[model samples]
Each structure stands twice: as structure tokens, then as C-alpha cells.
Target: MLSTLGLGLLLAGRVGAFGSPTADAGRRGADDLVPARSLQEEVQEVAALKPITLRGGVLNAPPFAIDNGDGTYSGFQGDLLRRLSQFALEDDYNLTFVLSPSPTQYNEALNLVASDCNTTANPNPREECDRFDLIVGDYYCNADRSLRVDFSPTWLRTTMSAIKLAEFEGKGITTLTELTFAGGTACVPEGAYLSEVVKAKFPGASYNDCPDPEACIERLKSGVCQLYADDELALKYRALNDRSLEVTREQFNTQYIVWPLSEKMNPQHSRLLKKWMYKSVANATLDELSYDYFEVKFCPLGLSGPNCDQDCDPIHGLSDRDGRCICSSTKWTGADCSVEVEEDLNTYPPWEIAMCYSFFGINTLAVLVCASWIYWQRNTQQVKVWQPFFLYLVLLGCLVSSSSIIPAVQQSSEGNGNVPACMVFPWLFSVGFSITFGSLFAKIRRVYILFKAAVTMNRVTVTVKETFLICGILHLQLLEGLDSNHCRLALGVDDFCISAMLQDSQHRYQVFRVQVCGGRDDPKTGLFLRAAVIWMNDLFVICIIFGSLMHSVHFGPKKDVNIGDAVSEYARLEKESTTALKERKEKFVSRFSSIDSSAEPDGASVKRHSSGGGPADETIDVGSTKTTDVGSTRRLSAQISLASHPEKDEEDHVVCETIDDLFVEDDQVLK
Candidate 1:
């Protein structure tokens, strides 16, 4: 089945171009473009001494060989064969192109090549064509052919893919193993060497001997065969024009395309053909032809790549002539790409293991340093050198605490229950010290205010020292009490003990005393806890000392006057001013009363006495006016003059002085 398809592809080559041309033009195997020395000069030199006649297949090989439709032949391979023939004949008889049309209906290319009468698809030894003078084309010179005819060191490299009708896709048939397992039948051209390979690989696979590759494809289309297997190039040739077929990625094998000649051929002719074919294999002409037909492929082996010869030899699926292994792609290196690296974390090298430390350490430090610097510049007011240092310490706490959290996370990931005591203690110390110091720094002024009010400078000095000493003692207290049954702050029994000692008044001092009596490391908690406690206690002392200093500066009143007395003085002055105004009004009223009494009674006395209680409630003066109501005084001025005038009869009223006189006693007094 495969043979018929391959034959059909071969016959259809001249109809249309297959695959892409320009796109794949340069994709010939790795060596396809490598320059090679010319064998022409050497062949010509040899030709001077010998006459050689080299005959090859006359039929067209498409891109390789063509019939030319006349008595002669031309094509890629045909041209190459003729050039080689000329070089081999060198000053000899005419080198002829013989027509070796497929003899058997199968037209197995090898059989044609093997026939004594002609050379065909390739040279072979089975048909007794071993006596041929010379031959070249796209031929697979197998081991048998190799013994019958010498081949150039480097042969044509092919990348093979399985091509099948699309209808057979997804049938669970891929490898020969799969076909044999599925109890499926296969078809191939009779006498093709691939038949022997398939039979060996899949002993149970049933196969039909088709006449040619095209027949096998026809049988496959007709459901007479489950599949046909052949080289990717031939299958691609058939699939190019037919939309009903497709090619797969799986490869059956890789074979070399080489030349063959009868062992009897003159050594000079054989050598010339060998050298020309090798050079041609790397030439541009073959590459151009290869692009239009087959999928250009390379022998990955023998290069420095993982699959190269030093890794895996192309001829065998195993290591090559060197001790170095051509590693399979399954192994990828992360370093220089030489070592076989493992995937498991446990197997990772020390440097890789340390990667996590670098990541966490550097990153944590960067954040802490930057944050601390920003915070210090913005919020700290004292401008003390220790301020940044303090901030640095706090940042250190944050970093340590953060690092401590990693162990827990890692433990969770690893599913390990053991908690590291060192990590736990330091994390706790950072937390406590951070909170304690932060609060102290925030309230420093408040502490100073309280302290300076209660102590003198000299006493303040003594108190501060005592405070620090007590702070140190308390810090020591905590350290020694760390592991005590009633003092430790751990999670289990030790935690209960720490809590009891710290919280129970009766046990607190005793806990400290006990620690003082005991030696260092006598069931002590840890150094970090001790250090953290010391820091916190010192912070407490600073707060207290600052408080005492503030108290000494502002304690009691610096003068006799109190803040309240100044307020009282303001109130007294305001009250006195209010009283003075009342007294003046009373004295003025008395004087006015005495004057009215001195005026005596008159004819107007009744009218005056009835209306005049004192001065008029409101006195109006020309250009000015003064109006007074009992206990209240108001003054107004008008510029208009007040002069007596003749009254109108309708509006005028009589005015009597007292009861008889209306003349003013003193106008000056009125003014």
C-alpha cells in the first residue's frame, strides 16, 4: 500500500510544485549548505589515464531525474548523474543514460536499480545489477548494497514521516506496534526493504504486496488495507494535491540516499562518482530540489547538541564513539548545560538551596532600610543621632519577625510539625521590643512632663540612675524568669509558668529573686529574649528619666503669682469699674436734688412739681442733646437752634412762668 502511494507521488512530481519553495529553500539539513571541495579537477586528472563508461537509469527522476520526453533524460538527479558520468568517463567512450522503466508491476524502485539491464530508483544488489559500471540518484544503499557497491562516506540524509489517508486518522494506529496490536492489515509495494523492517517490528501485522505505491494508496482508499507506510517525501507528494490525506509526525525510520556501482567498475570511476555525490549532497542544486518535494530534515546526531553524535549517534539509538553521552532531551541543564540536573528539591545543590536565603534576606533588608529612613526623616523631631539608629533597630525587629514567619510557612509546606525554638524566641522578642520602644518614643514628652513636675534637678539625676538600674534589674528578671514554671512565655508548660510569674504579684519578685540566686543557663529561656527584655526595660527607664526631668523643670509655681491669681485680678478690675460708675451717678442725682429744692415753690410749682422728678429724661440742646432716664444716661446733639417764635392760632399753647412768669432766669445755665 505504501509503495503504490510512493510511486504515485513519484509519478506526480512533474505536475505541480509540492510544499513551500522559498520558505523551505534554505532548510536543507545542517550540512546541506556546507561548502565542499570540488572533485571535478581530480576526476579530470584521473580520466587522462583511464576510459570509464558509467550508465544509470534513463527515466526522469522528477526534480532528481526526468525522461525529457525524448531519447535522453534530464532532471536534478539525472543532471548530476550525467555530470558524474562525464567526470568518470574522462577521455573515454560515451556515457549513456539507459531507460530502466519498472519491470515488475510493483515497480519496487530497488528492483529496477538491481536489474542487470538498467538502474532505477536506487542501486541494489538483489537483482544481480552489481555488475553495473556506475549509478547515482536518490537511492538507499543498504548493507547488502554497500558490500556490492562502495558508497561515499556521507550519504543523503532523509527525515521520514508517516503519511496516511485522513480517514485513517485517530484510529489508534501509529507505531507498527500499535498496528500489530490492533490486528490490522497493511499494504506495501513488493520487494521494498521497508516491508522487511515492518515485518520485523510488527510480526503480527498482515500485509499485501502491492504492485506500486499508488496501488497501495488505492487499496487503502478502498478499505482493502488499514494503512500504508512509506517515506515522508513520497507521501507528501501524494498528499499535496489530495485534500483527503494528511501526514503525521511519527517517523518510521531515517535512511541515507546514496549511489551504487558494480564492484567491477574501475576504481577511478567509482572514486569520481563517490566524491561528486558527496559534494552534491551539500550543494545548492540538491537543496532547491529537496525544498519543492520533501520536508527538509537533519541528522540531529553527531552535532554538539544533546542528540548529536557525541550524545547519540545517528546510525544507532545509543551512545556514540566517544565516552560523552548524547543526552536525550528529557534532561535539561540549568547551568553550563553539561551536568545532568535533578528535578527534586532534595537533590538540588547547595547553591540552589541557598537561593531562597538570598531572596528573603536581601529583599527584607531593602524594605526595612528604606522604610526606616523615610519614617525617621518625617516623624522624628528631636534630631538626635540615635533617632535613626533607633529606627534602624526597629526595622531590624521587623525584618527578624518577618524572617521568623518564613519558618512557619516552610514548615506548613513541608508538613513538618517541629517548630524551631530559636526562630520563635527571636520573633517574640522583636514583637515585644518593637511595641514597647515604639510606645515609649511616641510618649516621651508626656513622660518628661510628669517626671520634671515631681523631682528637682539633683534628685532627678539620682532618680534617673536608679531608674536605669531598676530597668536593668527588671531586664535581668525577665531573662532569668524566662524558663521558670511561672515566668516563661512559651506555648506549653513554660508559657503557663511565665504568665503566672509575671501576672501574680506574690510570685513576681520571688521569680526575680530565684533567678538572681541561680546561675546563668539555669533553665534560662534564651539570649534573644533576654536582650529584648533589656531593651524594653531601658526604654522604660528613658521614659521615666525624661518624665522626672520634665517635672524638675516645671514643678510648682516659679513665682508667687498663680495662673488663677492673674485671672482673679482681671475679674476684680472689671467689677470695680462697674461699681465706680454706679457711685458717680448716685452723687450726681443728690446734687441735682439739692438744686431743685433751692429753687422753691412758684405759681408754676404745681406743673413743675408734677412733671419734674429730676432732670428731664432727655434734654435736647441745639447742635447737641443729652437725655437721661432714671439710673441711665444718654447724650445727643443737634446743630439746629432753638428760638421762641410767634405761635399759630390753631397750634399754639399758652406757657406761664411758674403760674405767672414765662421769662428764663438764666440762658447761660441752659447752655
Candidate 2:
């Protein structure tokens, strides 16, 4: 105690003697605190020029990028982009954010920006395309994406996991093997990395696909799919919010997340981006971001439900509740719990709980609309042959919507896993798509023959067997359910265009696609293709049974009358629609040229650029989803134009006419 007092006295004496440390080294120390390169110098390296605009994509995933219903984006990623611009370019660059439209479009948007082939500003003929420099939002590094584009350093390392209701965690699901033994299906986004592990580790188990995490949870709770698999962070977030769901394994595996730069980004801009990433990591950007997104205090994982150790002050609420945090005051919620609410609920409201219901609502409305259209034209004769196709579409919509599974259309987004939608949607989605697109394709093929056929063949019949065969080909993910769509949400996807499993980092993040449908169609060529190979083994049996029988069967003057002339009229309309497709394609190819390393964005200029595409400061439109089906196949189809083939002369203009218009010519002939 004497020594401590003596030391304090000595420090006071020294202060009296020299006044302060500032007296001796104030000038030098202050200089030392500044970076070797002044902010001005850093700006100069890139050259202070007029602000340049860069195009990028915005994907809605909370804590990363949250869509603010009013046409703006909020959350960690949104903030980071602003910070990065300030830190990297000193706020000199303008960013034009476009909605990616799907999970897989994360990289597509990046590549499109890099390649300048999005057909946005400059029409086809690559040299004149509109250009975007780079994009960032829940992007993970993977081998497949590496081939197509370059990525900045890994930004975050993601841990993969599966989640179940808290009460069921005590069940036999302690391990993946047990999950398989239990025989309960796991739910995942279509094509997610976790699905690969599920298939290999839990080979005997079945899994279903959902459009996203919230949808997956809904499926899990409803018993459509009993388990949910995804990245540990997101799963952890859900588990914390809804005490009902618990993360089975928080650290299943980790993968590096990164912000991808355009492959063709200017060298200066690339360097600047790298510098920004380095500085962000070194200068507390990530630290602050983590605190904001992951440090919520409302009954966090360890303190949830029965495990809670504290209670809110009685002044805030009438009483304290177990397993949930009760704030002492409305002004501050998590604060009284010794933690702070992640963000202001008013400024950043939660994602619409009933957004997923759009899958059902929209589809149901579509069914009603189509049915009504058919009813009105029931006696018109023009609608007779079209009824079957439209009916098929209505059935397809029901399956995709899975209204039966997602019963509580307005259910809160929190703890949505295990709803019946997960299980039922997958199988129905597969069957629905197979029947929908398959029928459309087949019918179009028949019309195509009649219109363009060199010779008038006698009679033709497309029996259910052929439809079944065509439908079978599209059912590559049938066994797994609708996982392909979910797989896309977890980027760096592999074969079947599936995301990479943590099993092998080297092979992680591979997504195989053959561009079609006016260059937007992404086909399942990798992992799902392997499933295709296995499915092919069933081919011989089908051929032997159906081939002979089909050959022996003949039709009694199949549906259409004077098919040749009817098809002729349809052919001309198709050709005109083909022209529309050509114009559309010519319009989307883009090359981001206005961007420069030293570009300084004026706030007004950035606002101007973003405003032109939409009615807001940020081009904030939700990417059209791959139906309610998991990423398994919808990403490949969601935004793909009906022009399956891009050629000027011949393209699949399947949707050029409504069912009514499609059959009008045929009806004319029959009548």
C-alpha cells in the first residue's frame, strides 16, 4: 500500500515537473498516429477525377443486406458498402445497386459487372455494353466461381450447420449419423453445401428444399422436413431468436466468404479494393459490423428459455418472463438486459413475415385468374384445346406455392422451420415443374413440327408416356426433393450447380451451368448431373416396357384439326416473338466503363444513377425468386427469358401468347 501511494506521488511530481507527456513528444507522437500515407496521398494515388459510377447487385439476407420494403437496403452489407466506398475511394465512387433476383445471381451480378455483358446499357456487340465494376453480399470463395471471376480476400469464414426445434434437440439427433438413423428428412435451400454432407454422411436420410432459411424453418416446424441445414451464423441467429429452434452443431464446417471483383476490373480499382478490404479489417470495420449484426441480446442462444439467468426490471413490463428478455424501458430493449438491441426497430424493421406467403397468394391468384379466363371463354371454342395447358399451369402453381404446407401465410418470420411446406413442396415442385415446363416444351415441339415440317406426316400422338419420359428427365433432384434452389442461396455452389460442402475446401464453391434462355438460363450440370447419371439406369426398363407398347398404339384423329394450317399461323407469331427476344437480349449486355480507380462520386450523381432504374435512391427491387421451390432448378429458370435459344431465326418463344391466344389459330381451324 505504501509503494502504491509512493508511485502515485512520483507520477504527480513528474507531471508537475514536465507538465505532461505532450510537453516532451506531443508533435512527434501525434504525427506517428497518422498513417504513413496521408488521406490526401491515398486519394492522389488513384488520381482525383470526376466521380465514376459502378454497377453492382443487392441480395436480401438480413444482417448482410436487408431489403427495406420502401425501396432501399439496410443491414451490415449495406453499411459496409458505404464504408468501403468512403474508406477505399474516399467517397469518390458512385455505386449503382441492381437487384440480383436470386441467391445464385450474387456471382452472376458480379460476373456480369466484370464481363460487361448484362445487356443493360449498351446492346449486344460487347464493345458497347453497360458496365459494373464489382459486387459484395454473402459471397463465399469457391473453386468453381474462381474459374469465372476473381474474388477479393475472404471476408468472413462461414460455419455450416443444421437446426431443429429446441425441444427435439434432446432427441436422437446428436450426430449426422443419428439423423440418418432417425429417418427424419432434413430441409435445406436447394443446392446448398450442407446437402452434399447430408447425402454422404446421412445417406439413408431424406431431405427437402426451401427457397431460403425462413422457408426452411417453416418446413421443419410443419413436419414437411424435420431438419434444417445451412451456415452456422444464420442458423445461430434463428436459434437465438426463437428458443424453439436450436442449432444442432454450430461449428459443422467453415468456408471463407469474400467480395468478388470483376475479372475485368481495372488494375487500379482492383488494388484500391484490396486496400479497402485490408484497411476495413485493420481499422475496426469488421469489429463494429460483427457487433451490430451478431451481438443481439434478446435471449441469445446461451441465455434462451430455461437457460436464462437474468430478468428485466419490473418497471418495463408487468412481470419477467423466463427464456425471454424483458426490457426495463421501451426506449431501450436489450440495453437493460446488459446488451443492446441490434438496431432501431423503427428505422430498420424486420423482413415481412408473410413474404413467403406470396408463393401461395400469388399462385392461388394465378390459378383463379387462369380458371376465370378459361370459364369466360368456355363456350368461345377458342379456349377448348388451351384449357388443358392452362389447367396444368394452375396445378403447377399450386405445387410450387405449397399453400397446404405453409398454412400460416402471415406467420412471423422467426422460427419458421419445420413447417409442412418444406416436405411437401419439394416433391410437388419437382412434379409440378416437370409437368409444367415439360408439357409446354412438348406441345410447342408438336406445333413446331406442324408449322415447319418439310412433309405432312400421317398422324401424331404425344401420349402420357412421352410426357412421363420428358418429365422424368427433369426430375434429376426428385430423390432429394427441391434442394437445388436452396443450394443456390449458399453461394460457391458445385455440381448440379450445388454449393460446396465443407468436406473438401478445394472443391468448394463450384456451380456448373450451360447458359440458355437468352443467356440467363442456368442448367443443372454438376452434382445434379451426377444424380442424372444414376437416374439414367432406370432408362432401359422404361424403354422396354413403354417402347413396344407405344409403337403398337395409334391415335384416333388426335385433338387438332388440319394441324398443318393451324401450326402455320402459330409459327408466324412465334417468329415475331423471337424478334422481341432478340431486342431484349441486345438491351442487356453491359460493360462498366465509367468507373475508374480515382473516381470520386458526388452524392447527387450516385442518387441520379440509382434513381433512373427505379423510383428510389437505391435500385431496390427483390430478385424474382425461383418459385417456392428450393434452388435445385429455379435459379436456372427464374429470370431466364422464354427465348430458350438466342438465335435470331429460331428461339423458344413459349410464353409469347396466353393459353387463349396460343389455341386461337387451332380453334379457328377446328371450328
Candidate 3:
């Protein structure tokens, strides 16, 4: 039985027609995005631009790109484009932000900006320098871009340094070579120039990027990218909130910024646009813009400008009101708003912390302990009828109690960060429930065999013959029961596909028919009538056979009498007292049989001594006897007359005496 159940579960679990409906059906389009390239590669490709219809995606310039409602562009890129639009159209040109439906579309827009199909910031000259001019957004000057376009002296100049993790301080990471070899890695924006420098200088070091400086630096707290490497100004904006990061390496190069114009660019109207773009790069022009966009600070005392304060806090250099930190309402202060106003732990909310702990810590073992207590209190010393079922239930409870085992083992063995859901539930249910059902069916077969033996001969061993016959019959019956429609949630039908059929009353009749006829169709009613007949027929046969065997063995004929002289003399007296004779007959047989003989005569006749006042009664049919009842006077005389009586009378008296003895023996034997 166990083997059969296990095989059934195995068959159900096989990669066959019974697989889950939702296994690999649906997927999202964004999941199909292509692999990302390095920042250097991205910049090189973006430098090569061409024309296209639409260009819109999220612009990631920290403090510059603002995500405004109604999907229209704003911020530094917005302001720069408006000024240049006067030169292109002689009026302000408004750039509109549009949502990219998917990652593929988003990347396509970025590619367009790179190719000059639409506007883009800081396209390199090596790829598409002649394709289009940079009208808006910051343009960086490189050795390659300088060959194709003109440059201003410089709009912004700051230190270019490597920001090592604070933990790695005092480790002598002065040179670019030492910074790369130092156990920590760095991060840079996807298309930024500094990302290129790190990749070139230290090919073995790990570097990552994000479009925005704040986002790129946030990875440090997440432990994604350990160090943020960018222009000093951008890193300073990030460090205002997270004061732990500090620049470890000295400035490698002073970066120059300029707007490039296409050689084939429309010189007729674009000349004025180029002049305005350069004019906009003036010191005061950028300083005000930078101050409005970001909370800037001068790092180190010597680099402080007139606006830069020498008394600025060392942690942030200087505080801008809108930076990440804020004063607590209760006088608490910290970088992440984690400081306490009072020293008491009770002042801190207790329930919330407890709830958080429970969410992560509570397990099935805790549930099992509670459940076991309840079971023990209820069951005590009582034996359960479904003993095997209860045993399997306990086994399942144990498995649940140790539920952490599989997950802990898997993680320790495979070194994976996550567990697969599909493998857990499917396999667990198959194993646990199979044991439960197998044990349950086994007990059922056992009880049935015991019953069959006791009813038949009163003595039958629990041999293989009885066990196999009983269990096999029940197992086949179980299979039949499983296939029945009502038990299958009453959903089976042959009209349409079975799975597609809904559970409605209309389908219920079909289910009923299938259950009754065992899937056989009847010609007259077009239903399965034979199923009910066969099922009931088997039950009826078992009932009749069992009942008959019990009856025959239990209430078979009784022949306990030994008819000697004693039995014969009782028979003579019994013949004389018919009332006693009738009562005794009824009393003896009433224990085993329900035959009605209670209406027999109450007295015997003296003439010819007939029982029941008639001819010899055959109520006791074990033997043939004719005894004449002699009256009381005659009874006394009969003893004297016995010697004088004729041979025929003596023969009759002998027969009666012998019959009486037999009745006495029979009665004693029966008792």
C-alpha cells in the first residue's frame, strides 16, 4: 500500500500532463532589456548620434533633473534648452518629458540622443562629433572631442580624486595605482568621464555607475559599490548627507567644460546659439545655478570662495537648509534621523520593535510546541480509532516543526541568496500527504480483514491470503472512489473539456450520472445507471454472505440429549403434563431461534396419555414416542400392575422411558 501511494505521488509529480497551469506562461516586456555596457563604452557610443522622431526618458542629473508632474522637462537641462531655443527658432523652445513605456524604449531614446537624432548632453567627438551640436546640458572636454569642436577656457574646474571608504583611511592610498589595489572598489556615473579614468588606470578594480550622483553614492550604504568616484563637486553634494565618505587620492586632472558645435551645423542661425551657450558658462552664471540646484561647499580651507564659510561644520563643510539632514521635533539629531531625544529605552515604542522581531524570528517549531500541549491534554490515554492517521499527522507535525531544516541546509550547501518556491511546496506536499493517506488506507484494510475472519469460522489466522484479499479489494475500491465525479468535486463531464467546465448545478447532474453508472452510458436514460447497481451489488453480496455465515455458525442445530431410562421417564411425565412440556419447548429454543410455539396446550389428556390432549405430540421431533398418561390412582396401581401388564403395554412403557431419558440428556447437554 505504501509503495503504491508513493508511486502515485511520483507519477503525479512527473514532468507530464499534470504540471501546474501557471508554470511558465507569462512574462513582462521590461524583463527583456539587454545587458549593460561599461561607462566608457556607453560614452563612446553616445558620441555617435543621428536623427530620429522622439527622444524622452528620465534624465539623471542630481539636483538638475527634476521629475515634474504632467511629464514635461524641467531643471538645469530645462533652463539651458530654453535659452538655446531663442537662437534656433527666435523664440523659447520648450522641451517636453515623456514616459518611456519600457526599458527597451528608454535605451532607444538614449541611443538617439547619442546619435544626434535628438538633443543630448556631452556627446564625445570620437563617435558622432560632427553629427550634431551640443546646445544644452554640460559638455566635457576630452582629447577626442577637442579635435572636432571648439572649447572655452573652462566653465568649472575642481579636483578629480578617488573617494575611498572611511574604513580604509590611513592606508596610504595617495596614488591612483594604490587606490585601485587597496581592497576597496569605486563607482562612477554611467557616461561620466571619471568612470573612464578608473577603468583605464586600474583594469582589475571593480567600478559601477548610476545616472545621478546621489544615486551612485547611495550604493555605498547598500554595499553595492564601495566608493563614489566623480568630479569633486558631485561627490561633495553626495557627502553632505553621508559625511563618512572622504576623498583619499589627490586630484588626477583638472576637467574642462565646453559646448561643441557641429562643423556641418547650420551656421546661419547656430552662430548666435554658440555665443549664448559660452556666455552662460560664466562664473557667476554657473555659481547661482549650482547653488539653486545643489548645496555646494568648498572642500579644504584653502579652496573656500567668498561665499564659502571657513567656520562650516567639518562633517558637511557647510549646511544648506534643504540637504538630507533635519532637526528633530524632540531635539534628536543624526545623519539618518536615528538619534534619540531621551535616554530611556521605554520611551522608544516597545510593541513595534517586538512585532519586527517576531516577523523575522517566529517559526513552525513554536507552533508545534503549542499544538502538542493541546493534543496531550485532549487525548490522554485514549486509543484513537484512526491510529495510523493520527500517527501520520504527528509525523507531519514533526516535519513542520523542523521546517527550518531544509532552508538552512540548502543555503549552507548551495551558497545561494534565495530559495526556489516551486521546489518547496510541491515536493513537501507530495511526501507528507502520501505518508498520511497510505497509513490511513492500511489501517482500513486491517480492520476489514479482522472482521471477515471473526464472522466466518470464529477461528481464522491473519494470513497473507486474508490480508492481501481484503486490502486489494479495498485498494481497488479506493481507486474507483477517487475517480468518481462527486468525490472529484463533482466537475467531471464528457460534453466539453473537463478542466474548462465550471462547477455549477447543471454540471452536477452529469457528475451524479457518472458516479452512479461508473462511466458507462445507459441507452434508455443516457446516464450511468450501472455504476450504482454494481457498487450496491457488491455491498449487498458482502452483507448477505457475512450475515448468513454468522447466523449458521451461531444458531446451528442442538442435539444435546442422550435418551436413556432417565430421559424416557421424563418424556412420560412430560407427556402427562402438556403445559410444562409446551413451556419448556418455547423456553429452550427462544435463546437461539424466534420460532412461535407459545400456543401449545396447557395440560395433557389422561385417556391414552396423549400430549396436548390429542394423539402423541411430535413437538420434540428427535425421536418417535407414544406414551399413555395414567391417572394418579392408576399411576399407583401401574407399579403393581407392571408385572401383570401385557407385553404390548410393557413395550409402550419401555419406549416412553427411553424417550424420557433422551430428553433429560439433551437438556443437560444444551445447558
- The number of the candidate with the highest TM-score is 2
Please give the range of 10 consecutive residues that has the lowest summed lDDT in model 2. Answer: 589-598
Judge candidate 3 at residue 312 and give its lDDT: 34
lDDT for each candidate structure: 0.47, 0.52, 0.44
1 or 2, greater by lDDT: 2
For residue 233, model 2's alpha carbon misses the true position, in angstroms, by: 1.3
- lDDT of each residue in 1-671, candidate 2, tens digit only: 43333233333433453345555565566556533446466345444433334445565666677778765577777776656555533444422234333335343444454444545542344532234456656766777667656788666667777777777656656545567778768887765545665576667888787766678888888878767877766776666568887777545547777776666666876776677777788988888777656645444433434445545444443222355655555555652355545543221122322343444455555456545655654643334444355344534534442443243322224443434543453455456556556655666665555455423324555555665566567666466643455544555645743334453444444635545566543222222332233223223322342233233333334344444466556666767766766653342222112112213222212112343566333222223433222213121123323213323222123233222342353344334
For candidate 3, lDDT tens digit of each residue in 514-611? 53545754222311222233223323432343344334334644433221333345545645666665765664455223213222222422222355
Worst 10 residues of 3 by lDDT: 632-641
Best by lDDT: 2
- Candidate 3 residue 295 C-alpha distance from true site, Å: 5.2
Over 4 Å off, model 2: 1-50, 89-132, 172-174, 197-201, 296-671
Query: Which sequence of candidate numbers ranks them by lDDT, best first?
Result: 2, 1, 3
Clashes of 3: 25
